[model samples]
Target: MQEYAVIVAGGSGSRMKSDIPKQFHTVNGLPVIMHTIRAFRNYSADLHIILVLPEIQFLFWENLCDTYQFKERYQLVSGGSTRFHSVKNGLSSIDAVEGYVAVHDGVRPVISKEVIAASFFTAAEFGSAVASVPLKESIRSIDPNLGNRALDRTHFRLVQTPQTFRLPWMLDAFSVDYQEHFTDCASVLEEKGYPIQLIDGAYENIKITTPEDLKWAETYLAL
Candidate 1:
């Protein structure tokens, strides 16, 4: 089956306290988004890449690619005000009616090739799949009116992306009434009663959002 990767790079790095978007920030002298694109490309050279970026940052992304000699031919989609809307915009650019489509965060460049392939194969077999890592730290639930309370960690899974789904199923999910609660594409499907199979996700596949994350990314690249 055909496959595609949608890299969502629309977020502003407000938490990073930088004027540039986090995805545009450099790690080992390459943009974080470029590293993310390369990870997918390394996994599957034939996979079509669709990059979703904010309207204001479109020129910057293009210029960055040109300056760096990034060779992939990725279709650019103008992102919306929210992550869900940004994904919808990217989904609209794809003409594929069948096969698997994986939506990944552009700032998460450390996702291993194994996880990428695993998620794709799982989605191809099960129709929908999400990459997730089990919580290692102690779990807790906090009452808004009271203080924090320890809870069971068995029920919790830290979801990461490269969330894969059948193209038709994802399209249908987006057509429904949108909500702010839809944090990821999988959530959108879950709202529509679609069962999402989970695969092991790497803890290293962290999205760079803060200065600390950027620093960590640089150190990661150094390894």
Candidate 2:
């Protein structure tokens, strides 16, 4: 079955204290988004890519692609006000009926090829599959006023990406009207009564949001 990746790159760098968007920021001399696109491309050269960019930054990304000679077969879609909306817009750009779609964060450049292939394979077999990693630290629920609250760690799992789904199933989920609470594609599906399965995701698949994250990403590249 055909596999397509919808890479969402609509985050602003407000937390990073930068005027530029986080995806455009440099990670070891290459743009963060470039690395992400490259990662998927490396895994499957024939895999189709669809990029979702914030309206204001669309021209910037286009120009960067040209300047860096990063030519690949892909389509660009305008992002929305929120991450959920952005993903929805990207999903709309895809016309494939069969196969699978892997929705991923554009800033997460370190996702391994093995994880990408495995996630796609699982999603193709199962109806839906999400990449996740086990929590490494002690779990705690903290309240601003109450301090720490007891919570079960066994019941929780850290969700990562690329969250893979059958194209038809995902398109059906996105067909519903948008809501403020729709945080991710998986949440949208869950609200529609679809069961999501979890797959092992690499801890190194971190999304770069802040300046500190960029620094650590640079260090990660050195190792």
Candidate 3:
């Protein structure tokens, strides 16, 4: 079966305090989104990449591609008002009946090729898979009436992306009415009664949202 990656990069740099979008920020010499795109490309040379970006940022991305001489091929889709809609738009570019699709955050530039392969292959066999890591910190639940209460962290795993699924499964799941709790593709699938398979993800597969995350990406790339 064929493979595809839909990279969602609709951020506006509010958290990073930059004039430019965070995904367009440089991690080393390359733009952060470039690194992310390369990760999927390196995993499978034939993988079709669909980059979902806010409509306003299309010109900036085009200029960056030219400046860096980015030669990898990809289809660009206009982002929507919400992440859910953005992903739905990207899925429109894919063949729903014949492939596997992985939904990824564009700021997560450090996802290893091995993890990428595992996600796609696992989804091919089991229908769906989501990358996740064990939680290392304590967990707590806060409510105004109940105050704060510590919960067992062992029961939780921090979810990451490249959430892979059979193309038809994901395409159908996205057809439902948008819910506020659909934070990730897995959440959308789970709501539709699809079982999710969680696989080990690299700890370094961090999403760069704030200045501190950019610092970490810089240091990691430098090393």
Candidate 4:
């Protein structure tokens, strides 16, 4: 089936304390967002790529693309105030209602092509497939009244991106008014009564929100 990837990159790098957004930061002499786009492009050369970024950052991103001699094709969309709206904008770029769409984090460049393929294949079969990994460390349930108690970590999974879904279903899911609880496409689809399918994702698939994450990605890519 035809596929598309909507890569959202709205980070301002506050946690990384960088002047530029974390997605624009360089890893292994290449921008993080570029690596992310490459992941999808490498997965399927024919897949349509939609990049969502703040309007103000478009020129800068384009200049970076030129500087790196990055020639992979993608349609750029202006980002929204929040991730929900940003993804909505990206989804709107795809004219076709048939096929599958994978919403990914642009800062997460360390994802494997295997996971990318699984996401599309599973989403094609199940309507939606959200990439995730089990929490390795201990977990806890916190409440102001009840204080903190150890909770079963096995029951919880750290949600990652490449949240692939059927194109028509994803478009319909984003048509509703934005909700605060819509943290990911999976959550938004779940609100629309779509069952969320969790797929195995590598632990290396970490979002580059901080300097340490960038370092980790660089190290991972080098190995």
Top-TM-score candidate index: 4
**Candidate 3 CA-lDDT value:** 0.92
Give the distance in Å from residue 196's predicted Cα in candidate 3 to where it truly belongs.
0.7
- Per-prediction TM-score: 0.96, 0.93, 0.97, 0.98
In terms of lDDT, the best-performing candidate is 3
lDDT of 3 by residue, 1-223 (tens): 8889999999888999888899999879999999999988988889999999999899999999999999998999999999999999999877557799999999999889899999988998899989999999898999999899999999999999989999989888999989999999999999999989999897889999899998888877676
Preferred candidate (lDDT higher): 2 or 4: 4
Residue range 24-100, candidate 4, lDDT tens digits: 88899899998899888888889889999999998998899889999999999999999999999998888886989
Candidate 1 lDDT tens digits, 102-206: 999999998888999999899988988899999999987889999899988988999999899999999999998779899999999999989999999987788
List the candidate 3 regions with Cα displacement exceeding 4 Å. none
Error of 2 at 158 (Å): 0.8
Give me the displacement of residue 157 in model 4, in angstroms: 0.8
Candidate 2 TM-score, C-alpha based: 0.93
How many Å off is the CA of 31 in candidate 2? 0.4
Candidate 1 residue-wise lDDT at 166? 93
Instruction: List model 2 lDDT by residue over 88-121, tens digit each.
Output: 8887887768879999999998888899999899
lDDT, residue 131, candidate 1: 95
Error of 4 at 89 (Å): 0.6
